[model samples]
Target: MLLRFTTLSALFFAYTLAWAQQSNSLFFMHRIPQSNLINPAVQIDCPVYVGVPFLSSLHLNLNSTGYSYNDIANGTGTINFPALVGQMHSWDYLSEELHYTPVSFGFMYDNDQYFNFAWTERVESKLFVSKRLMSLFANGNTQYVGNGLVTSNPGLNSFYYREFSFGYSTRLRGDVLVGAHAKILFGLAGLYTKRNSVDIEIDALTHNINARWNPQVNVAYPIGVTTDAAGNVTGVSAGAFSPLPFSLNFSNPGLAFDLGFVKPNDPITWSGSILDLGFIWWLKSTSRFTNDGHFVYRGATPADLTNPDAYIDMLADSINNQVQFQHSNGSFVSFLNPKAYFGGTYAFTPQLLAGAHVRTEWYPGRPVVGLTLSAIAMAKKGSSVSLTYSVMNGSFANIGAAFNIGGESFQFYILADNLLAPFYPERVRNANLRFGFNLFWGCKQKKKKLSIPESSGGGCFWTWGLDQKRKQHGVK
Candidate 1:
């Protein structure tokens, strides 16, 4: 569990990933074929689109609300433990989401129906902390000799998996569009933790600490891991993971569903979707640990502070003596974080549209609710550009943009949410970017154009009056 927590945090810092990588900026870019990734119900006019295999999407996100880099160090690069503590909240936490797409494609079927598929790998994790836990680790418990602290809030959850998806969409009667997607999931790795309750109190007279702790942890590892007499890991498992086909082994399997709808009312379109409603069962190389009852700590003496190493050793010994972890081997099931979206767009003209959306994405104990306003400029040649401003969670200052360069045979698109993070991390807490290339086929015309004699001196306009309307519209 310690390794799982620390390693995930290191990866976020090492990669400098941020929170706003859900590709929200591309949602309104109508001409971009990738818009469907945001909402399966979003039907673009693309007849066929084949993504550039592994280049389809690579996304990373880091979630946090406390301790920006500057909070821990002043401009002179000096460690300020006091400053860092001051910047922390009652609960400080961080999480990450990573995604890699191996293959993706979309095609229109039965004239009005759209079909799409994709294979993706995903990793998601969240690390939580309580102020009491932080103070206990940093300043020690003696500082608050009489304080009763609650340290049960700390939590950690991480999951890794692979997903294969199939989606279909078609227009219903009265021009109402409906879509649904089914996902098959394969679990690769996981660490799930639940803290039932914890309470701690320090007796002012004797400086004796009484603690009540209850927690549960479950994990999955590759084969050949050695355990000690107490079920503690004595050695790390060795080997690289194999990306074998999911069907080769169904040791871990899960299912999910996504449903979406779009209703176009002339100048306005209303859209909504429910996404990632799913779960996965883990059966391979799984284990769980649980702890209950009380742990006591005789507060550190004044002399103990002089030798930091001795003090830590004593604390570790005390914790081990009091907290008995019961280990068990078992299979467990986990659920995916689901999301909901509602949005509407108003078209001022055929080429200009303004839209706003309310999108909610959830984590174990956190739900991110975002509101975004976007404007898209669509071109007749299947090109588009969009700008967006979003407010989400407790932090704002999220600005995003997307530009799609379209051609007859190929399309390239770039999208970013929270543009400020790339340039100024200090002021931006969330950031994201998504780019991809797709080769596509356009809609096929069902009815051929009528042949009209140019020599007639007057084209199909003789009686239809359409030529006059076209001339009025400056169609030439």
Candidate 2:
């Protein structure tokens, strides 16, 4: 019940006041090494760029499709739960995800290939509680004596770990580029329920309430756990724990791969990528819990409507005493939810570029899909800025922006999608921001000439191979 309520509180804002996982504005800011994370095929002019480690990249994103702040806010700026419930639909579910990258960097090899690496962390959560269930919790089981209420897939999953990634990108030939990033993941702490289905049945006359819980809960390095008489986890753990920065957890290991392709053309550049195709294996210090049987709640005496607190206590005590968890220890493999990106950019001028892309994130629940249109204004001195409009998870009010300010040797960049949610915190459902600094080398061209034309360097489409101007010799 505690975990369930916590997840509900997270859903109240509909995951608003948080960032979107797919920062559309940053993804197209090619001048920043960060774009490579979205599309490995993207190349930066810098031959080498190292992140400041811990300060290099900090990212956070939270988004939802079920509800928004506007649905609950009244003229008084107060929370109205009953009002929020009216905006919910039967099929609507709350889903949210977050990612943080504390360490990252990229280096380009003279051989025309780029090597990039980073350590990334992630958290994902989702819940779909039935209206009947909420009503029962709020009003009581007396209203619906015969109708069974279900709290479907109520889960809050936490994954704390680090990802060491090695990425490589190069030009296959003229007008073509390819890249791939392979990742090795180390799980420090995790709690997930791969399978969960719960239902509450109320007896009309007997007033006996029955709860059917069927779930397979997995935990890694969990704290504050209490087992039942049969070794089942009647009480679960919740809170935050910090993990070692560089140590390896032999028990928790996983792998992921990212592949991208760029087809540079005359006026237009086409690019696409498939991200996070991988899975993790949990081994050491892991536990799995499942319900031993069912729990029947008849209350202490008769259904006491005057004092709700007593009824709740009775329900909890009954559950703890009746429902035993079967604990088992072993290993488990969990697959990563993948995402696909496809977009094309048009060069309006040598300094201006516009593009549109589609991003689809595949999860265990419903997939998150969106369309983004972006434009970038590149400066002659290697500085650049971008703006974007995105429509995700069936909402169409996401407006984002990005800017890179720095010299060839050092670069500072920031990006945000769904930026409006912060100011109008009372009406939006998604928000995010990503910022970082990098030390770069060789962003500017070297005096030495190479086999590839100077114009073929990184930047807009029409400008490829057009960097060199003639000496302008004249008759004496």
- Taken over the whole model, the C-alpha lDDT of each candidate is 0.68, 0.68
Root mean square deviation (Cα) for candidate 1: 7.0
- Model 1 reaches what TM-score against the true structure? 0.81
**How would you encode candidate 1's per-residue C-alpha lDDT over 1-476 as one tens digit per residue?**
32233334433432343354656786666566666666777565545678888888777777565555544554545545555556666665676778888799887664457789989888988777655556654565677776677656466789888899898888676556788889999888888887565677878888676878677888876545565697654454535566574325557889999898877665567778888999999998787777775877676688998998999887777766566677678988888889888898886655677899998877655566778899887664557788999886456678889898873467788888788886777545677777888886643223233333322112111111223323322333
Choose the strongest candidate by TM-score: 1
Cα lDDT tens digits for candidate 2, 241-293: 44553245556888999999888776677889999899888876788776645
Clashing pairs in 2: 18-431, 19-61, 19-62, 19-431, 19-432, 232-325, 455-464, 455-465, 455-466, 456-465
True-structure RMSD, every candidate: 7.0, 5.2
TM-score of every candidate: 0.81, 0.81
